[model samples]
Target: MTETALSFELPANLAVEKFIAKLSKKTVIELALQQYSLKTFYDSFDWRLYNANLICEFNQSKNGSSLSLISSLNGKVITSTELDDVPAFASEFKDNVMANKLAMLLEVRALLPLTTVDLQIYKINILNREQKTVARLMIEQYDQLKTRLSIQAIKGYDKAYIRLSALLQDEFSLKTAEKGLLIRALKRQGRKPNDYSSKLNLKLTPEMTAAEAVRVIYKTLLKTIKLNEQGTIEDIDSEFLHDFRVAVRKTRSALSQIKAIFPDEHNAYYKEYFAWLGTITGLTRDMDVYLLSFDDYKASLPESMREDLNPLHEFLLFKQAHAQKELANHLKSKKYLTTLHDWELYLKRFIEKEDLQKNTHISIKELADSRIWKVYQQVLNDGAAINEDSPAELLHDLRKTCKKLRYLMEFFQSLYPPEKIKTLIKALKGFQEVLGNFQDYEVQEISLKQFSEEMMQQGTPSNTFLAMGVLVQGLEERRGKARHDFTGRFNDFKVPLNQKVFKFLFAHKSKGE
Candidate 1:
């Protein structure tokens, strides 16, 4: 079904019947026109878009005020291609779809016109029939990045609402759904399986448990996307970069929350992915934050400084673009495809079919840790296997390991004292920072070189490019120093790691301050 949600009311000046008649027939529409009293906590008609899943919404009252939020259709929970056509439809109905009825309180039969068909995942309950063909929202387990987390307690809608809300919290199940898409991605890419995801699913073939399936789905991200750091998009077109940033943010958020749900032993795998995603996404994100904090930082500057700022922006943009391309390449690789496919197969196998019903209460850490650690050790070995020409790939793998460790510690941190875990966390943070700085600088340097060349070719002014060169020089030097320091610090890790410091910290962690 199309993932678009459109809700519009007729203007008070205009006839409600006329507006409803005009807008009721979408390319494929299902209508629920019913009066909804505002929740007591929200006395006003505070209607917000549910999630990123919202395509476009426009409302008009008989009065002359309206509201609308533009949307996109990436990773929409509802699998409908019609959603791709929503923007055009929105563009078509822009004028009459919204009402100018400006009332803080709206208490008519609020129409909810949706464009989707797959309603099996949704079960609506019939409270007193309000003549609305649509069932009252019994369950809502959806969240868009823009959507606020909320709880609604209707007198009779509690069961479905609670069930769906609970299901949404179990991300393991969501990831399994995503894993299906990943499988499609893999077949689209032409790759074979690594046997990890499928094997795990096979073990769970008896009956399906959304809870149990979650663990396996998480393991896939730990194995696949966690290997590379995120890519930035500042250097691209503004619109492209904006969407790119959003995608990166969502992916990182997904990775973080998914890892957070697993038992302690399995936590290591997620930690590594989180670490890597943070490292890669940091440079451009820092720039974005800087821009957000000091809007005039780049535009208001002395001549020399302006020159430097121009180049710096150029350099950062280049790095961002390069990072995105790198990530894209990584995602398209055989290794990634294998992981993605295997993950989906497992999801379909385990989640769709409940296997472990009898002994479902055991901690999954034992299973996750033993399995992931074995793979992680092999990753360390595989990284070492790369020749000098492939130092980058090797380094990527190393960062992956660190990410796994970070994921592990973070998940298990609940079991340990903050103080005990502090030292180890600090070190992990440092290691991630060092490599991150190096990567950003490398990208910056390359971009500067490109800008300088392009300027020479175009015979543009030199001051900005020259200033950028100077900036890169400073960053490059710092990066060199950081790398050297990181190597030394990497060696330093031997001390605590030898004593099983992380494990010890986790084992003895305090529950409270």
Candidate 2:
């Protein structure tokens, strides 16, 4: 049988030299010590690596630096690469197994430095009868505050490992450690792996009032916006702005959909401000999308003509930077700051019973069912009315309706049967994708035409305009395809099983109405 590695915690007052002397007396041991200038753990802001059952650590020494990807479950190194310095993105790593693995897991997200610690290592060799090393031990002290001992078994030397483990346990009365030094260090700083994510996962109960549940949802969304604000202003990556806007949209959708859950005055103030927030942030986000998809944009054209789009790329970067600066200024403005602060205070403050709205006092389940069912019926009605020649406005309106329904389902996901609600959501998502793509393509095509006129006014080369025209034509084709696919996608969503699940889960209660 293969022996898995083991780690043990030493008592706070135990002296390392004294422990080594005691161990040497029991068994012949060879020791080597080394110190690292620094050891840091890194992951995406969303904790992508940690969620994938992996952790990345970088170690700096006098000679150079090294990065290793380790399995969090067993504390085994999967791959290691030597680097001159730390990289901000996975694509910067040298071509190797680690680079390939990281690229797959961390698409566009930048690696963020999470925790750093001063590390010292004491390596010990367990010898067999002939004085040949059979097993290895690593004693690590982190930040001079805690120490850990790890036992790694050598293949064909399980007996030695078992004997050593038994001796440590029986003679020293050492207890096994539940986690590694890196994890413990993170805990010391009050941070946990997998603590931050962009997705919404709320825990709500049916017994709560509609007003209470909405408050909880808004609070979470507000936290998300605050968390991503700095990154967005710094333009770290497109996702920060993307996540921030999503939270804002969700807040707006809640205010609009869950009508009468808040007083009219409160709802009107927030809805107007959030709409303003969305408008100011839209241009930068649009440029981000275009730039992120530029590679694919190039691929869609002929090889010889692709270079013609280079000017467009440069133009986009300039525009994006200008828009980003404007957005940063807006975010720092007194109006923006005060609005968010007021919204936060409103969500957090106490409310008198007499001031609550009609829906506020009803159970959350009733509100969820009523809102979701009403939207679901509207979706079916609107989708069934579209045909080969329906105006684009109909699909656009349906898209917004579908989004509102999606938000409601997600907000109230916890109050229903997990698998059943998930099934309905899955169906809705497929339908939404067709509508979303259809709308995005149409919007992009229109924007490109306007951009070409602007470029012409600025004396951009005529060939760039030709290239853009080709891009616009391509977008129109894709948009047409999506519109064509809508019928089948909508039909799939309207299938008997999906209809059954939606009705079974949401349509049963109409008490809020």
For TM-score, the strongest prediction is 2
Residues 1-513, model 2: lDDT tens digits: 223479887788876667888999999898855555678898888989998888899988786789888888887788889887778777788857877899899988888889888877788988878988888888877655567888989898878899999988999888899876667778888988767799998999999988888888999999999999999998877888999999999999998888887788889989999999999999999999998889998999878789998888888999999999999999999999999998887887735444667887889999899889989999999999999899999999999999999999999999999999988889899999999999999888988888888888888888888888899999999999999999999999999888888888888877544
Model 2: per-residue Cα lDDT at residue 113? 86
Which model scores highest in lDDT?
Answer: 2
Q: Looking at candidate 1, what is the lDDT of residue 348?
A: 56
Question: What value does the lDDT take at residue 255 in candidate 2?
Answer: 88
Worst 10 residues of 2 by lDDT: 348-357
